[model samples]
Target chain A: MELQAIGVQHPAVRQVQHIQNNTAPNRYKLFVAEGLWAHNMLLEANAPIDTFFWCPEAIYADEAHRRAEEIAARAERSFRVSLRTMEKMSERDKPDGLLSLAALPRWEPSDLRFGRTSLVLVADGVEIPGNLGTLIRSLDACGADCLVLTNRKTRLTHPKVIRASQGTILTVPTVEFEETGEAIAWLDRLRFTVLLADTDEAVNYRQADYSGRTALVVGSERYGIGKEWYGHGYQRVAVPMLGSGDSLNVSVSASVLLYEAKARKANW
Target chain B: MELQAIGVQHPAVRQVQHIQNNTAPNRYKLFVAEGLWAHNMLLEANAPIDTFFWCPEAIYADEAHRRAEEIAARAERSFRVSLRTMEKMSERDKPDGLLSLAALPRWEPSDLRFGRTSLVLVADGVEIPGNLGTLIRSLDACGADCLVLTNRKTRLTHPKVIRASQGTILTVPTVEFEETGEAIAWLDRLRFTVLLADTDEAVNYRQADYSGRTALVVGSERYGIGKEWYGHGYQRVAVPMLGSGDSLNVSVSASVLLYEAKARKANW
Candidate 1:
């Protein structure tokens, strides 16, 4: 594998810096995934690779080099940058020696498939990228049908979100809706029972029947589910907080509900 | 109420800076809790608060000022600092304008009281302050008897841990053991069923019986339960991950198990 030498002033290098700083516009549709695990995830998901950056000194493992070689082979462009250049491209204090730029996958509502026993997670207005990413991992672990991102504050492909999800964000199917009502209406048309996680007249989450097609609506930590989602015949269920906190972290709450549904359906 | 004026050069101000930077030694026996919610939790828990700092301009809400006044009345030392100095003392981007220096609570093995159906979360080798803080909140939410900290990489009173735990670190009883063996032996002497979260020959987490006195042992993400934990009469349980990622975040995993046990024990 021939490694193309690059400098910090190169357009591709600048692009990586932009992506790391989150200054790059969405028009680029490019994401910077850092570290070996991310490289493997991009490979496993067959993400469209635009470029691969490597630091030979940092990648000591033979298996890692082989995987990087494979990635380079699959990419349209690849380069070997100096450790200092790699440092500038990395968001973490310690760069993991491998980084890749992949085109974000586009998904439409039709791309999702829901079954009679499907569990879909509808995230409404989640501001924290880390929380959204954690939710993706939790949803994926429980085998949720797909995540419908409605009223999202951060892009599904944000670097922090991608990293926090541990690359599960790449595999999980996601569709975005600008309005919560539109998302709810789509779920209603699909004959899915929507359970809004709210404190009003809420029942223990375990009591809510999750055996069949279900959609759990999790809201932001501050504002909660949009008022648009209220009074739509959606059942309100709460994760009982036995202590002083009014709510659990949004990600933790979603995971608990997802696992409960999975357990009831015997998905594990 | 008269404001005790202070400036950047004040000795107390220097101490706040040291605590925020995490440069203060354990010998100081002081931790800073920032923001309004943390202040309230400190008040409710009756934590030994040594000092309180307030910015009147930031305390706009009537209820907030009342709470600040209440805190000031109870504190041994209280001062009003300029907004600029308050910003310097805060770790948050937008300082909430309230900071408290509290004496770290000391606990021992004898402080823990377990019921027949008690659920205890044993955090072994949890290296991240954020993860430890989240675990404290999760365990508190599930009404776990206490969190036994063993093989901890970060201090339980780390500002980030306290901030992440939303000051629950003060309310939740925590006893630390320098070694994992000491923690395990204590659990054994109490006849607690130690369920270690490991992927090796593990049963489904949901399939495990968590109805009785149970202690779920959570390990670090990189190096799971130390080798010393093996060969113990402990059951290995796994939270199934159907995604490309290997495991859930440590805090998320422990919360799931803690809630499961709480749900089973009907302790909610």
Candidate 2:
């Protein structure tokens, strides 16, 4: 395959840079996945790659070079670029020489399927991209079905989210609701047992029933779950903080709760 | 009390910048704590503050101002600086008008007192500062007795660690061993049931006994635990990955295992 050589200022390269910088108005429509881990995961998941860019000089690892060839074969459009151009396109200090652009997977409430043993995660007002990504990774690790973001502060396509998620964001089904009410309505309609993680709550997380259809809700670090989330028949659960620190990190709390749910559901 | 006014180039200010930038040779001797949470936690722990620097104009919250006065009263030396100077010295884009320098607490194996039901965490070769800090925070939340670092990569006093730990690093008794053998010898003498988090292990974490004196060992994300850590009678435990992700974030894995130990020890 003859790969077209491109420079830093190439139209496609500029488009990728714009999307990465979040300077492009429709940035959320497409996302950039960089380096070896993301590339390998993308291939593992069989996700469609719109375009692939690789720097022969920058790819030092044998596995990376092999993956680059695989990506080039599968990508709709593939291009070769200099190491300098690759560095300019990469967000990390050290570029791994492979980058790809893919359309953001759009999911809706209707798209999510709930079964008798469904486990859903609702993250409300999570401001940090890295935290949101970590939440997705945890949700995935616990075998959760879907993620519903209410008052979502960061784009799911944000590079940090993709990187921190280790590309699990591509596998997990996620939807966003601008209003918390809409999300609540959907969960209610699905007959999901909603569990809100509250620091003040008396019921310990392990004590909560997680069998059957369950939805775990976690909020931002600074301002917790919205007040509207309360008085909605949702059970409040707390991870016991036995030390001087008042609360665990938001993602840490979510993972603990999710794992508890996982163990209970599995009867482990 | 008359507050000493300082310029950006003031000796104390330069010293802080040097420490924050990790440019000073003795950067590990003193750590910088910034923003409201760090300030409040530092005071709550009664950790000695070597110096406090405040920017009145940059402080927007009423509680911050109140805390400023309290910090000034307790700090060995206090200075008032312009917001520009504060921003220059701060690591975050938004400076919170409060910063402090404190001597890093040093602990030895002898300093740690293990009880019958002690929970100690051993983090090996954790390269990321934020991840290390998060590990400390999770260890604190689980009410762990102390943190033992073997083949430690990042400095515990790094600003990212301090911020991510929410100042729990200041309170947690942490000792680092350059050699894994020394750490193993100490744990053996203390009769701690060592549990290493391994991806290849078949023993599920929850099935493992965490009662009595316990130590949970987690390794760097890139590299698993050191080779010397194996064949030492330290039982290997694994968190079941029910989804596509091969492993959870190192901190997340540590927290889940720590909480599991916490619950099992308490018989919850």
Candidate 3:
């Protein structure tokens, strides 16, 4: 194994720490993915890795060590760091000793490919990284063709999102647009019907049709869909909330809606 | 407004800090609820309050101060703590200048009252406080009759769970059983059909019958339902996952299932 211990002051460690910021990840074109699960996901997705670091003693099981070695073999640069050093570079309180810095994969609006009965998810101004990540996992689980983040605040490679998504971010085809208008135009040009999860003047989600090409749009929890989305030929559907907690968590809302679409698609 | 300023080293502040642990909240029969939203929820539910704390500067609007004063009038004792003290006592980084120590309501399994067509949630060994909180919110939104926590690890009044639940924890009818066997026996005796959210040998959730008295149970993400639950004649149902991430977040899973039950109940 070509493993050499690196110091806390290593440039690679510094880079990983700096990339935790909102803009630095995009600026550096690098992001951090930690833990054995995320590492395995990166390996499964065959994501490009710039630097891979692991602590020898931290990996307990022999099989896990073998897998870590296999992952290290695929990386451009590999190093062994002290447990303390690993802790400094890790985002989690309990570090699993596996950390990777990989080049961010770029996906644009034009890159989104839709099938005859495609299902897409549009995150219109989602702010929280954990919520955004959970939505990505749900979107991927629902087999959505693509996820488009409009009026984006959090970077696609945010560590909290990466952890919360459990590496689905690496596997799912996700893209971002600066403005919701761009996303709207793309949907319009693709002949995809838009369904907004709005509470007012909306039909029950079960009654809404998701038989053909459809894009399910969910907005921030605090604010409903933007006013600009109203005039368009979009149908608003509400997930029936029966009690005082008037609004569901954004991630939960997305899951129910996507699964409802899946149910309709299957004729259930 | 009978609001007196309290010091950081006050007994009440220390007491609040002590109750942050798992056992202390229940031992003392007290739990902390922070922010205006939770405060309002407690008032709406007419929950018993021990003490209410707020900062003068934290109350931004005159109307908000008036409401705080009205809530304080109902409390046994009311005090205004400095912003610094409030920050220390508050669980959230952005404190809304409202914190309350309230008497935790005791709800036993016997207290669970169900209708003829009751919908119930059984969180079997759900460990994460946030996930549990989100489940409470979703369960409340779907108008489930009650939430029965089986083999629960976290206290019902954990600050993180309360915040994540968006004060729904204050309103939802919830009870806990130390053992899964007890929960199963309770459901069986009540003639409530048990629907376990198990991925193995499970039918699609849509196909499961939630027509009459039903108790939908979800397990921990790491370890699913225990083996003891197998021979109880519980129906196993799976939420169809279409992509690489084989499992949905526990909270999201519960929301979709409860909403499905709600949809069926309404015939939508």
* Top candidate (lDDT): 2
* lDDT (Cα, tens digit) per residue for candidate 1, span A43-122: 89898899899888777678788898888888889999999999989888888778888877877898877887988898
Report residue A227 deviation for candidate 3 (angstroms): 1.8
Error of 2 at B231 (Å): 1.0
* Model 3 regions more than 4 Å off: A23-29, B2-4, B23-25, B94-96
Candidate No. with top DockQ: 3
Ranking by TM-score: 3, 2, 1
Error of 1 at A246 (Å): 1.3
Error of 1 at A38 (Å): 1.9
lDDT of 3 by residue, A93-185 (tens): 878867889865777777667888888888888888889999989988888888888877777777878877877887788877777788889
Over 4 Å off, model 2: B8-10, B82-84
| Fnat (0 to 1) per candidate | 0.54, 0.81, 0.85
Docking class of 1: medium
What lDDT does candidate 3 reach at residue A231?
A: 90
* Tens-digit per-residue lDDT, B1-268, candidate 2: 3698999988889988888787877734798889898888888888889999989899899999999999999999999999889988899889998999878778878877778999999999999888898989998888889999999888877888988898788788898898999999999899999999996855988789987899899998899899999997778999899889888999999999999999999877
- Measured against the true two-chain complex, the DockQ scores of the candidates, in the order shown, are 0.62, 0.80, 0.82
Residues B159-224 of candidate 1 have per-residue lDDT tens digits of: 778867866777678888888788888988988899999978999988898867999999987897
DockQ of model 3, rounded to 2 decimals: 0.82
Ranking by lDDT: 2, 1, 3
Interface RMSD for each of the candidates = 1.6, 0.9, 1.0
Report RMSD for candidate 3. 2.0
